[model samples]
Target chain A: MGKVVLVTGAARELGVRFVRRVQREPDVDRVVAVDAVEPVRGLGAASFVRADIRQPSIGTVLAEHAVDTVVHLDAQGAGPEGRAAGRAFAKEINVIGAMQLLGACQKAPAVRRLVIKSTTGVYGSAPRDPTVFDEQTVPGALPASGFAKDAVEVEGYVRGFARRRPDVAVTVLRFAQILGPARESPLAACFAQPVLPTALGHDPRLQFVHDDDAVEALRLAAGEPRAGTVKAGTFNIAGAGVLLLSQCARRLGLLTVPVPLPALRWGGGVLRRAGALELSAEQLRLLTHGRVVSTVRAREVLGFTPRRSTQETLAAFARERGAGPLPPGLLGGAVDRAAAVLAGARVRPPHRQEAERND
Target chain B: MTDAKVIPFGDDEGRPRAASTDRGARPRHRPSAGGRDPRRGGPPLSSVPEQRSEADALPPGRDAEQQGPGRQETGRQEPGQGGLLGRVLGDAWDARAARGLAFLRRRLTGEYEVDEFGYDEELTDQVLMSLLRPVYEKYFRVEVRGLEHIPSAGAALVVANHSGTLPLDGLMLQVAVHDHHPAQRRLRLLGADLVFSLPVVNEVARKAGHTLACAEDAQALLTRGEVVGVMPEGFKGLGKPFADRYRLQRFGRGGFVATALRTGAPIVPCSIVGAEEIYPMVGNSRTLARLFGLPYFPLTPTFPWLGALGAVPLPTKWTIQFGEPLATDAYAPEAAEDPMLMFQLTDQVRETIQHTLYKLLVRRRSVFF
Candidate 1:
């Protein structure tokens, strides 16, 4: 508990909040915030180091810090782009960078807990059917950017390392779409539309974890006594509320635009072959079929109690950004557009149908 | 793929009747050759490379049979029946061939039925009991209880802890349900996916009607109102080493309960005594499995590559007992969605199996067939 904690990619929004959370936690004595970008202003006396985790020398620098709890949040393409660049960057930072950091952490005797902030995208895109994807379900990730796949590979390494060294608690927290003030999560960009796009007959099951809860889980993971992969091995951290894309658009008061065409089954293949996309069709399938990772493991293992609801998360972001109300016809526009293609197709809410039992 | 369908050598009646005098004749070919036929039925020499002699082809018993007479006293062989020498050589040879073929079947195809009992008999359980009764009466005693625990008719989930060395517990439970229980029924088991994937395994597994181990498969079987048997312990519990035998591992977040919760079938917990000690798994080589993509490399005493293969299952008198049915209709389908509830139920089933194993083990007198 007296050891120093180093959070990579600490200058980013989620990374910064994580550093702040670690700094606030009673167990953490010192935090060394490391990032390739310029250090954020006013992060108060907490040590700051500027170094890209992808660099080979970064491990030596981290070892020099004498830091123990290494919370790796460093990754690339944390922004929207035309696939290739995003994927290359994500692999470099999340996968390659993580391995570099992990290699260093393995050498450092002081490092007891290495908490890596992974995405549930590692779980892959959602499924077409609304089945609750628990920790038990095998991860069938979508082809989006290579971020999820890369992060998942890193997680496998982390799990293997944890198994090898029971002394160091290696925690891989798979978070949902993280959204908060100034945070540029995929969800933020996803909801940043004047006309929110929607998938027809597919209301992807999404898990949105607030930055605060996300950090709290990391803090708890860093402090827990047991070191091995906890619970279903991977915990699905979501916010208090679960909502579909259409519902989110409705809540945002944004204009919904539904394409009348069938689900974009061939979009990923076309884009990848054209060198415009990095994710494969399987990866896209992950996106098409959303996941529901059971949070029971998190709650039981880490005693996780989420404070912010999905509505609260969006509203707080809106309030902080001073964003105005959503357009009135946003939701109806998409529904009307979808209905125009298939007449009499009911525009029912996604969660209206109860989760059917496999029976 | 179709090559998997070739009838086993012993079962090949379609071989030209004229060739029967040659390799087809029971004990004739062996003496003509040097003690054993080099052209024995084994995996294609291409895959395995080593073609063993009659003595070396099979485990020891095979040699004994081949060394003995396989021809009848009348010097005549029936269509199905084998003479004294034929019984010894044929049974031994067939069993060896079965073992070799079963192995190749598992490796190539990935499907194999792991029968807890020796074989599937068509006769009624009472008839089976009548056959075993003489043996039971001569060497050991038999008893039964909890006949009412089984359902009269309906597809039920017979959830049981599987761990009688080579799955003897599963066989006893099948027999208990078939003979002792009020409603005579055949239990369709949810076998590991590997059982169906392996070549020869697929044949035996399909014959036994054991499907892949998954909630979807279990639910489908149960939806049709078939008696489904499930071993929640999976590989962890089944493959537990000898020292840790009978100590149940965590039942993977109760897919069985979820299956029942989804299908509204009553989960009947079952316990079979005298299975764990049959041939305690001394060790399992995971390294081999990783290399072979198999679940584990089980190393049991009798199965030690080269030795007396028929280490007769310590026919430790087995008694199967079915516990009260745990109904799932009360819980909504979404109720199965509750991870906590699933975990709790999984643990309950594990405990029930463990407690039963301990009781059964205590009652067991010795280990021998």
Candidate 2:
């Protein structure tokens, strides 16, 4: 009999894509999609179960479907909203949601495979990180706050669940900052801006994985039972090579404004208030000293390699941002002028909706 | 070295491979005789491919042609020049501002790429090294001996005596290896965390391929066949008092020896004289340095009293000598695990450098000569 697969976070583009991909597999019989909200559009022949994993009712939904495999992707890109209510709401959806889901997965004897879409952000960005973190580098600094903290908490709960259910083959994919068309990340938001704010005088190394590569890795992780020994391994997924923050901006035709670290702290507060930057203070460490994770295990064991290089992933974002018409050379001149204005004189760049000036 | 050949250059143009040098790092315009290889007398064009050692043949980020409308090419008169004032303006722009703008533009527009380790060959060559060139050649008048000790290819650990209050010796040694070595191989130096803690210094150090002084980083470089330089003395060597100038400090626990053994790279003992005399630290200001978040506040003879000029190093005649390559390849890889073997090799390398430094100092007639 074909296994019945239940995928969480069906509303997300990644979830929506995964459900469709998994449904096409001959080995997978039934695809049950679960989330708080229904996907705006149809997700193939998969049944959509409207339920929040944060609530205990998600267990009833899982039992009804007899989920043989659970693919958790809800918290992949959860950002803590600026307000306390929003933060609490995000936590409920992410941390509490994962707790509820894992509790259900532990009880469900039929669920033989569990795939959690985690991020490399749990490793945290710091001044003294290993040049590249492989599968085993202890996160030097665990994220103190924000959605990233939620990820760490979720992983901790997942680990707890793994110990309880040794029968279930668990695969935690720690994907690098995903960048591509249709994906939304703090990095993408920064690149989308005409003037990219960066840590002044620092060109921190950056790594990225394309949205497509992330989906492919997820599919590979999901197709485990039919293949080799279904071992539980936390895999770090990323494209090859890395780019400096400045280089990323340059490729996108976005102007880089290097703000002093102190001023940037202040600016970050202001940005949070204005709702200009979707990312939190902790995310700033990413721009200050960017993080890179190795895909060695993922490549060798999982049999996955990202088709896009970091530069190519970034270029996809640039292409999505519509970097044309101004011409690259002229764009460079404009970047210098903007930087000179910011660094030399305290030019209060109309940073929010600042593009209205051209109109 | 007479095998001159032009590299087949199409595949490496736009695609970022890995940089050996950048167009930004064009060798300075110096007159050369006909048929002489002008650029720093680097390895023959035939050897260039092998010497660069970048597995992927990525050329330095070449400046893309971005000839904007309304801006004429800076040089060469385009027939009808708009008389005297326009001619002067054009001449002035072409002579000075154009080159400066182009350089800045190239930098801003990503014409120079940094490696995964953060080494920017262009920045190291064009900006940092250019600033230090005059000081290397003229101010210090650095006399390099035993360049033959450095291997023309493959990995070698340069275990050098680290001295001088500000550690100018590291940059000088980098220049020494690049300019004097037959292959013009780059030196990847392992740096202490204190250097990386500073603002601009951290970025520049990374650009120059000076990563955190750790075994993981060092081994990775060695395995890649990079010439890795390590100053085992670290802070102690740089912070020593003027009285103990030539006395080499303790090479810490011989981490470098283990690294060499593991990677099977020969250790080249390097002794640098005259660096100790520059900015002589007569006393240490521990409290003040603590306030500054510095390892040691150097109380140089000319410093604190003479302001910024006090920070200026005295023009001392310098000598850097490289001793014979101590082969770690002879030992089995397991030797790296043996603390006893590592200690013996570390002490031997330290002693060789110290002896070389003493000999060089005693032969010197004058400090400033």
Candidate 3:
């Protein structure tokens, strides 16, 4: 018999995309997408159920659907209105919502596999961090608060759930920043700005996974365990290679203003207060000391590799935003011309030919 | 020709007016004395004003006479370009200039690649190494020996004695390995957390292929067949007073040996002489160090007294000698976990470096020579 999959956080773009992908999987007999708010658009073949994971009533939806597989995708930082919707509300949806969802999943005996969407933010960016983090590397510094803390809490709850239900295969896919033309993430918003504010003297290595690859990874993890794939484990899902923040800005043809860490944080707070941007403390830490994780486990065990590299992913996002004031080709040409002129002036005497002719 | 030399023509206007006066004053004695001058063939006094007008109109032309040989040599090197336009373009579009422009274009377009550790090989090779080459060649006059001890391929750990109030020895060692080694392999140094926590130093360190001095990073690099350099006597040796020079500090719990054993990378003991006398740290101010969050505030004779000028290191002749490699592949993988084995290997490496330092110092004639 094919598997009955239940995906949470169906209203979000990533969630909706994941639901659409999973519903088409050969092994997925039915897909029940659950969310507090009704999706603005259609979910195709998948059925949409209006149920908040924060409440115990989510159990009824799971039991009614006989969900054999649960894909939790709602553990996100902020919402459509950004952090303007108060931290408490976001935390409630991310932490409490995951807790309640796990509770429901545990009671449903039909559920044999659980896949949770996690962020690499759990690794916490710090100066002392390892150059590249694998699955087993401990976070150098645990995040004090913010979405990273929430991710930590949610992962802890998932671990507890896994221990309680040893029969169920729990897969936690820790993904790097997800960027795509259709997605609207905090990083995307940051890139959308004309002037990107970066931490002075820091060009942290950043990694990104295309949204299509992210959905594909989720689909792979949610499906039934195949011969070459591990059924359940923690895996880092990110595109190969890394891009420096300055390089990203250059690629996007955006001007970068290097702000001191303290002033940048203060400015970020002001921007957040003014509802102009969403620069959380976690994001500031990320900007200061970029985080990169090894996706080897995801490739080796989970049987997933991102189709696009970090550079390619950024290019796609940049293409979607249209050309910036200084396209890379134009900038490169300008630099070449300036260098040629400087070189010419430095080597050749200006009036040498005229003096030789006169003589 | 004598007038050309006397007038201070050709790009002099581009310089400050005071510099032009200084140049004109120096050449005045030659013409007034009526001495036998080199290149004395010149036009009569009647043509002097016309020549001056020509020089004034085409200032850049004046340099061609002075740099005539160099311009001809450059033209001969680029044989295809014979016309005026080609000559002008050829002067600027030499092979070196072309290569440099290409590198700049690649950087501006973000086309170059950096490894997962943020190591940009192209930038390190072309830019960083060239910038350090002058100091490595002239300032330090480093003499490298026993380079054959380093493996031509595969992983090898180079444990060097750390001294010098600043960490210039590490950079010099890096240059020595790259310039002197037959394979021209790059040395990936593992630095302390402090090296990565600072602002400008952090970026340069990462780009120059230095990672955090952690066991995990070391193992990762070693397993990738990279030649990794480590200074086990970190701050303790670097900040030690001149009295303690050449005395290797405690090799930080033998962590490097453990990592080598884990990765089965041979440990090549490196002893560096002359670094100890560069700054001659006389004292360490603990109070000031704590106030500034520094590990140790060095009190050298010139520092703080001479201000920024004091930061300049004394030109001391340097000798970096690599000792025989200690093979760790013979040991079982479990040997890394054994503290006794780790201690024994660490002590052996430390003794080798200390003994080599004494040998180099005994053979040395003077520190500044």
Candidate 4:
């Protein structure tokens, strides 16, 4: 029962939340929060270790603390800086940091469990994907670059390490586009704007998991080994059902700027420069034929049942982000939001599950 | 890095029929979206970001109580619900405050659900198929020969010969199956990448449950016991000159037979008599076809000359005949692997359909009878 948990990327809110969450477990003897930068948020009683996980120093920190479990959250999306730096920085931290952390976990005898947050982007959105992707659905097209590619590489390392450490329980949670009150996912950030860009012909379906569910899933994956609990495997954590891009844009009081595919690539760069969007090639692929993850494995293997559905999670994020602090000049964003709602398209809402008698 | 080629394009060669079918199937959806369907081949209009009142775009008839799943069903808002002034004032207050009501207002008002395959059944039935009903039932006057052959329930593979220069037969089959089946079953048509590659056609095809013509998708649907329709001839049967109508091009590796054997679902051979006469592809321009990214550009008597009016199909007095189900339940699931059996079964289904087409064509029935 003496669990010493070390959490990486503890400077971020999601990382901080994991640190605090692990600390509350009665069996967890100590919680070590490590990050390259000092955390601005309060960490309660958890000890803070300031070291970049990419450095070999992180291995020493793991050994010294006798970390029995390592929750890796350092892999993340791009930063606020220009597109080039943001992508480069994210790659270094996500791939390199993950490799170093896995190395440390491999050497540390005390580490029994490793839960690293991953994404469904590893599946790679394509026009020809299997209708539903279980964990085993061979990723149709591997991610080329951006956070998606980073996650793919990170997962590759994690899988490699799992083969070496037969004693360690390595769990990978491939989360769908996360959305919540202040849960800054790349997709969420896209919605943070008053206007959303979409591929002209496609209204791809989307899936989301709430922040609270993410926290719970992380904790469950690292929970003290139980007799009948979910075993170690890659699981997809997503809310049930999906929402269309048009529906999302309308719900957030935003105007959908339908851009043709040919012009979209150039437009993404222009918007990225103007501070209007985060238009990565990966994100654009997602926008064109949005990804949907099967939550069946997440439920059966990871023992998770999210409290919020995709619509609810997106609605909450839309609500919170729509109310975010903006300059007086951008108040017009609110009016446009309401007007889009008032003039929403004539598309009919889906038949309620109970009412879908044909199925 | 998630690279550029996610292999978004489906490589299923036989999925060629839906390009014509969906293009034909699209008349139901165009007028509703204010003509924004990118497949209509208009200039991609970049929505101008000008100083227009947001109110002009706000959707009407949305209120707080309608926040639940079936918000659109009940036409009237709650009795105590206020009007546009209340919403604008609430929105105004939301604008000033950090935690404004804007989020709640939008969140609670409208929510649309789409399935895993990106299909919106509510949209398909209410808007799409309904729009095509008059044209399908009246315009073509499509007659059915064997509605009784379709199983009222359970998974069955309905394999048909793909035809019509524009493949309007697929939609007619979908409508025929949907309208005439005793249990009111729907045919989940498997389309090729060509259909998904088009602009508006892709969106409508998906909503209408036309996915990639692949084994994985077909198996998943069959496992769930849903009826699946496949045009085994693909583009060869559809794009063949009118002279080759009903000849039944080789059914590519007998994929449908293998699919049926693997799933143990019965196979129903379907034949259409009049689709070959619809567009009447007398000739095709190779250069024009390459330019338009289409397999071939048809030179119909009226098309390219009549423009939009020429796009309309002639009332060919169509006839669809569904034959007896060829049982695959006798084969082991592993039987899908045997090439000899698959080849024999494929030829059997092909011969049955071809013979039936001849029989139907000769039934003292003229093209417009």
Highest lDDT against the true fold, candidate: 3
Residue B210 of model 4 has an lDDT of 81
Off by over 4 Å in 1: A76-85, A126-130, A140-145, A224-233, A260-287, A318-359, B1-258, B261-369
lDDT tens per residue, model 1, B1-369:
111111122223354212212221233223433323333442233322222132244456533322222221112223243323332244334333333333332222212211212122322221333343333322222334554665677768887776744554554555445433434567777777665444445334433445667665577678778788888777776677889866777777688888888888888887755566676678788798699897666677776564556455554554556788887788887997899898888788778777876887777656432
- Evaluated with TM-score, which candidate comes out highest? 3
Q: Candidate 2 — which pairs collide?
A: B17-B58, B18-B58
Relative to the true structure, candidate 1 reaches a TM of: 0.45
Q: Is candidate 2 or candidate 4 better by TM-score?
A: 2
lDDT of 1 by residue, A79-169 (tens): 3343345446666777778887877777777777778777766656532211344565664334344567677678888887787677886
TM-score values for chain B across all models: 0.60, 0.75, 0.77, 0.70
Q: What is the lDDT of residue A16 in candidate 1?
A: 71
lDDT of 2 by residue, B95-155 (tens): 2333444556766666556777888886676567656655776678777778778898899
Residue A10 displacement (Å), model 4:
1.7
Q: Model 3 in CAPRI terms: which quality?
A: acceptable
True contacts kept of 3: 0.57
TM-score of each: 0.45, 0.82, 0.86, 0.79
Report the number of the highest-DockQ candidate: 3
In candidate 4, position B139 carries an lDDT of 70
- Candidates arranged by DockQ, highest first: 3, 2, 4, 1
Q: DockQ of each candidate's interface versus the true one?
A: 0.01, 0.19, 0.45, 0.18
Q: On lDDT, who's better, 2 or 3?
A: 3
Residue range with the least summed lDDT across 10 consecutive positions in model 3 chain B: B68-77
- Looking at candidate 3, what is the lDDT of residue A285? 87
